[model samples]
Target: MYYLPKELFFPSVSLAHSSGIIALGGDLSPERLQLAYKSGIFPWFEDGEPITWWSPNPRMVLFLDELIVSKSMRNILNRNVLKVTFNQNFRDVISNCQEVKREGQNGTWITNDMIEAYCKLHELGIAKSVEVWQDEELVGGLYGVDLGHVFCGESMFSLVSNASKVAFIALVEKLRTENYKLLDCQVYNSHLESLGCREIDREEFIEILKVEKVDS
Candidate 1:
């Protein structure tokens, strides 16, 4: 792996490992994060670890048209049990994502620095949050950076069962309406797979990123 410099740049995705780690040891400044997402790279490291950048092979992504919403989830959406909003409480959404304990994970990757950096991006309209509210209380949500044609998801949290799913479905519907080309989940998980996210060659993903955007 390569060591990052003070400048907001990364090595070629072709140089990344099989696991997609492209480089290490960089600060999570907003500029770096912006450039990273724009170039199809992202930072993912646990607290106290050196900032690790990744542009994984077999990139996991969801095209808006390929989204899968189960019949059960469709029924739930029809029931209108939750209200979904955009950018209503980005900080709260990220804080909840940071606090939620997930299976097999002892700690969160959404460190304080990441929270601050993403919040800064949110302030500049480069990051966004999808909030799921239940009876005026925050129940579930997700946050991510908007890279023109691609929305790079960071993290999500759910206080109740299926709340996060509802938020994700809402976000996908909105993205589709807005004509987004892709939803970059960064890595794969069974949950995302169930939602119709599939892996493509990192080079293929990079080619899409190169041609699908309006601007940074």
Candidate 2:
């Protein structure tokens, strides 16, 4: 296991453990966070735990053109009951993500420090969010780091059924129009798989990131 030093740096993704942890013990400064995403790595650890950085072997991602919108979800979007906005209420969105309970989880990984750090990134335009409004109230939203060509999704929450899905679909549509290459979901979950997210080798992911970095 590698421990990060004071200087901003990360070991190769190839050095990551089978569990995907590359390094531990680093502050979540915007600079470090930016570098992490640019390198196909991300931070994920619970509150009170040392910051753990990971680059999973089989990275889960969504190519912009491959987003899956089910018929039921299409109906929900067509209803127009939910309004979607970009970067409108980042603090609230992330706060909701931190507080919203999840099945099989005792506590949230979005700690106070993590919120504060991400909020800072949001201020700098490196982090972005999508808000879903119902009856003019915030019901669902998601947030992530935006790296020009790739959006690294961090977390999302829904107070109502299909609300988060609305935010995600809206974001995907927006990214598609803007010519984004992919949406980085980091790791996999059934929910993401249903939305057309699939895993590719870390090398493939890293190569894409490299090409994106050069193009941008």
Candidate 3:
């Protein structure tokens, strides 16, 4: 239940509440966002709510070597029916993520302020995007904060079947080739699990973040 002060700082992840909210009431400045991701915390709050910082107990992550490309996904990649590009159109990618409807959700956490803030991060090259295009039409994509060794994924959207998956798979392969430590999926979801993401203790995740921050 800690509240952030005006200065740029975050409480230890260990201070997070049972719901993974470490603190509240902070602006989404690029500096704050970068520091948050570097320390394994991310902001996720509904519109009209105080900014919420979360560092979930059982953190979901994808080890680059452990990525699973199912048969169907493999076929899709091999077919090359879709084109995947990085940092090509970040605003469009995140805007689509904000607009795409999800089951059991009435609103988007990717609010306008969030979009503008992350767009600032993109301008600084801290936020990266993977876009999926079909005949030059933007169909699906994903965006996230990219630390040198760890990528903290925010959200993704797909207009056509398997579009987000395509974007994700492409990003994973690229990270693998670049020898990234892991992709931080943040919280767990069945979709991420199917792609070989699994939960590890938050302490473990924190330790990795610490090590990667040093190495980078």
Candidate 4:
């Protein structure tokens, strides 16, 4: 296992282990996190564990043009039941994500420190949140770091049925209209698959990230 130095440099993603952890023991400073995302590396670790960096093979991603909206979801959208907004109540969104219970998960990876770190990233305009509101109450939301051409989704929460899905679909539509290149989901799962996110080889994903940048 490789260990990171104090400086904000990471080893090549190719050197990552089969399980995708490339290194450990890096601080979540804004500079480090920014460099990490640019290199297709991200941090994922429990609260008691040292920070671990990963660059998984067969990365999960969504091409904006290929997003799927099912008949039911389309009907739900037609109802105009949920209101979606961006960068509104970001701190509340992250806090709610930290409390959400996930199936087969005994705990959450969104540690307090992680929340603070991402919030700092948000303040710097590097992270963003999607909020779902019903009757003026926050019901669901999602948060992630925006890499200009890509949005690395971190976590989401829903208080009502299909609320998170609504937030995700809205975000996808917004990204598509904005001409973004890809949505870096980072890993594969049935949930993301239903939303048209698929697994692509690491090399291809890295290439897309390189070519998909917007002017700063």
TM-score of each predicted structure versus truth = 0.97, 0.97, 0.97, 0.97
Name the TM-score of candidate 1: 0.97
Worst 10 residues of 3 by lDDT: 207-216
Q: Report the lDDT tens digits of candidate 2 across residue range 1-216.
A: 999999999999999999999999978999999999999999999977899999998999999888999999999999999999999999999999999999999999999999999999999999999999999999999999998888999999999999999999999998888878899999989999999999999999998887753333
**Candidate 1 lDDT by residue in tens digits, 1-216:** 799878777888888988889999978778888888888899889988999988988899999899999999999999998999999999999999999999999899999998999999999999999999999999999999997788898888999989999999999998888778899998889999999999998988998888775532
Off by over 4 Å in 4: 214-216
Compose the digit string of candidate 3's lDDT tens values, residues 157-184. Answer: 9999999999999999988887788999
> Residue 54 of candidate 4: its Cα lDDT?
95
Runs of candidate 1 exceeding 4 Å displacement: 213-216
- lDDT of candidate 4 vs native? 0.93
The superposed Cα distance between candidate 2 and the true structure at residue 140, in angstroms, equals: 0.2
Positional deviation of 64 in candidate 4, in angstroms?
A: 0.9
Question: Could you tell which candidate, 1 or 2, scores higher by TM-score?
Answer: 2
CA lDDT scores, all candidates in order: 0.91, 0.93, 0.93, 0.93
